[model samples]
Target: MKKTSIETYYELFYRWQRSGLSKAAFADREGISKVSFYAWCKKFETKPDSQDASTGFTRIELAESASQSAVAKISYPSGISVEL
Candidate 1:
């Protein structure tokens, strides 16, 4: 079998979690072996680290006008944006 990158497996794992499908069903739909799918799931099913920089908040550089405003913005690694 051709080796796949961790990112590819990560994406697949994310999709499987969000799909709400049975493991067997998801494996079938994704055209991967159930054994391989399970293995990847186990390998990647780690608790998220609150201190991990990639997922943690970082200092934001705001424009002069925006800095004066009360709202604050947060961006996630998933490309989600929010204002508070």
Candidate 2:
């Protein structure tokens, strides 16, 4: 089996949590072995969103803008943006 990057798995975990799909279904859709998916999930389940620097991931908390009229937006690294 080819080695997969932790970053990729982290992205997958984030998506899967929001996807509303069963782990089995997600694994099937992503073409990954269910066993491996389950294993990775279990391994990382205890990790906090704000990981140590070694993982190259950090969760940030931003205070709400003072202006009520300001639009809230979410931007993805993939160049996708959503404004609320």
Best prediction by TM-score: 2
TM-score of model 1 (CA atoms): 0.54
> TM-scores across all candidates?
0.54, 0.59
Clashes per model (N, Cα, C within 3 A)? 0, 0
* Candidate 1 residue lDDT tens string, 1-84: 888776677788889999999878999998988998888788666635233223444455655564556776887889999997
C-alpha local distance difference test of each model: 0.75, 0.79
Across 1-84, the per-residue lDDT of candidate 2 in tens digits comes to 798877677777778899999999999999988898897788678877677424556665657787877675788989999987
Alpha carbon lDDT at 61, candidate 1: 60
Error of 1 at 31 (Å): 0.4
User: Candidate 1: misplaced stretches above 4 Å?
Assistant: 49-84
Which candidate leads the pack in lDDT? 2
Superposed Cα deviation of residue 15, candidate 2 (Å) = 0.8
